[model samples]
Target: MRKRLQTKLSATLPPEQLKKIYNSFDIVGDIAIIKTATPNLENAETAANQIMVIHKNVKTVFAQSSPIKGDFRVRQLNLLAGENKTITLYKENGCQFRVDVEKCYFSPRLSHERARIADLVESGEVVVNMFAGVGCFSVIIAKKVSQTKVYSIDVNPTAFEYMQQNVKVNRVYGNVVPLLGDAKEVIQTKLQGIADRVLMPLPEKALEYLPYAIMALKPEGGWIHFYDFQHATREENPVEKTKTQVAQKLACIGTDYRFASSRVVRSTGPNWWQTVLDIQVSGKPSKF
Candidate 1:
């Protein structure tokens, strides 16, 4: 998609600025969002306009002017062209989600990851998603696997509202339970020891809430889909470092665990990567 957009943008932007356009852009429904540094803003505007022209489906174009930040993980957007609206319906894995881009956090990049985790779920397993932004992961799992029950919790009220709406939109209300408030508190009061699987997709707070995720799992222990951000040079392995830390933490919590798998989900920055570890935990420890 970037290649196609760039090919069309080349006609409007200078040769030197061609490569300046970031390779990554997001198309959430009818909106096209591009990230352009200050130096490349001019070219990005042209590209945004060109994008709408090339892709008739794109009715709006916005440049991501700031990094994803804040408790809600919303980014600052600069309108480049077309419609002023930010609300759209994003479809993924045969489920539909209505989202306000400026109010909630939804990433098309994680679509594959969501589906991957859903596929790993057994039919009767229960899942607790600590940072269930719009319940994308929860809804997908419920929609894909009929017997699974997912308790999706989010701190952001706007996200929670959208999550509830999405539950109805996708007809997964019976499968996914959307809750508003802090995940840690929710887990402590209502969700402890009920999950066969726990999802910690919020890397920013995943480590701090690690204990809660562990507590949510059954006494027999189960699976945890853990996400975290790690920085490493070319010589170091981020996944290994993360696994070691998590293993140490697990041992401290008296949970026997093994890293079933690990992979880089995306490059967050230079030498910084977002990684996921699929951990299998047992009630007692044994030497792996």
Candidate 2:
């Protein structure tokens, strides 16, 4: 679909500028999010219109004006084509999520990651999703894994509201619990020492909140799925740097843990990798 849009856009855009257009776009529900750089932004709407013409399912096209930032992790968007609305129903892994793209941060890119984490969930295990946006990971796990419980925590009230609705829409009310507030605060106050597996999916703040995740695990030990973004040059290893950084943080707090595995989940940009560390925390649990 993107190629078709790009081909149609080539008539107006220069060949040098053609490479500036991103090849892939996010299709959430009926909305298509296409990002255009400043150089090629003049033709952004044209591309969006072409996308709408090429793809029958896409009803709304939004141009991402800025990077995802702030406490809510939402980006600024401009309607380039079709409807002006941003609220939409997204489906993934048989679970439904109602989200306002402008208010809540939802990524279709994490679909595989969500399913991967769900597949790792053992029956009867208690999982705590520290950054469950719209309860995507939590809901997917609850619907896919029977006898498992997930405590979905999010700081954004709007995201939390949608998360509650998503739980009902997907009918995973018995398995997924939605909590509002900061992950650390929520975990410390109500979810301490109850999780069998802790998911820190928010790469931006996962390391900062690692202690909370560690404290949320049972003293006997459990799993911590840690996510982070790292920059690596030609000589440095991004994943190793992440592990070392995580180890240093644990050491600072006098905590001991073992790394089960580390994987490069995806490449965010040139020489930048999004990594996940599967860590096993043992021995005495730390006090918040």
Candidate 3:
């Protein structure tokens, strides 16, 4: 069915727009599928342009291709239903990370949260990004915050390749080190008692890695941006859940810490919120 629709779109769209549209699909696969009765060439062009800009530094763009009736495509492209571009960031005040939308994979919301986390990091800080996808958080931090060295860990080879490219594109290749492996193992070996700030953006599995993150933090103090999704009903409290998890981890390690802050960074789905916890770790205080 998809192949048939692709054929029809090829026939219906103008050669130029068809090329662009086809290229968009080629990069993103069926992920960016559009459904429309009458294809809007102007809107398609705009979407293509946005993709090009987001993937400016990438060698290729990979997208899912689907046929859309003209009206829906027009509405989506014009931001009537909101933009469809992935969250590969391009510009920042301190550093820049040009996303290769085709090869790299990630949500736009995650990219924005990474940028915000980058802003909070300081120079010379030892930073570790667990589940670092295509080095989004690591590249942004290294590029923007001088003196900070980042250990970016990911299991995906494709994302690692783009991660390396992003480090160079952002001109922070020297500061950002890409580690291609499961963060659970890689972080344990490379970052024991060294990280000043840790980013755990893998919401679904971040809780499982809390022990490693706690062990990796500097003794005197450190911060963690632990990402997790939970229900956001009036009776639900994401922050409290995060605190409970942190307390459990602290108990397991027999270490003491205090919660600095927790804030909702983005919404993952209906009634689901993604939150970050800022924790400060310390040793037992001596009696006066």
User: Candidate 2: misplaced stretches above 4 Å?
Assistant: 285-288
- What C-alpha lDDT does candidate 1 achieve relative to the native structure? 0.87
Ranking by TM-score: 2, 1, 3
Model 3 off-target regions past 4 Å?
A: 1-104, 284-288
- Writing each residue's lDDT as its tens digit, candidate 2 over 1-288 gives 667767787897777656556454688999989755463556776677777888898899998888889989998888888989999998889888899999999889888888898998999999999999899999999998899999999999999999999999999997999999999899889998898999999999988998899889987879999999999998998999999999989987777789988998887767999999999888654544
Cα-lDDT of candidate 2: 0.87
For candidate 2, the per-residue lDDT at 138 reads 94
lDDT digits (tens) for residues 1-288 of candidate 3: 334434555645667666545543323321343323344655564544444444444332222333222311112222212254543555544555555443455444455676778889987999888778777778778877889989888777777877888788878866888988877788677777788988887777778887777667776658877877778687878778777876776676676677787888876546878888877767522220
Cα misplacement distance, residue 23 of candidate 1 (Å): 0.8
Q: After superposition, how far is residue 218 of candidate 3 from its true place, in Å?
A: 2.5
**Counted clashes in each candidate structure:** 0, 0, 23
Model 1 lDDT per residue over 89-163, tens place: 999999999999988998998988999999999898999999999999999999989788999999989999999
Q: Relative to the unseen true structure, what is the C-alpha lDDT of residue 87 in candidate 2, on a scale of 0 to 100?
A: 97
Badly placed stretches (over 4 Å) of model 1 are 14-16, 20-22, 284-288
**lDDT of candidate 1 at residue 235, scale 0 to 100:** 100
Question: What lDDT does the true structure give each of the candidates?
Answer: 0.87, 0.87, 0.64
Clashes of 2: 0
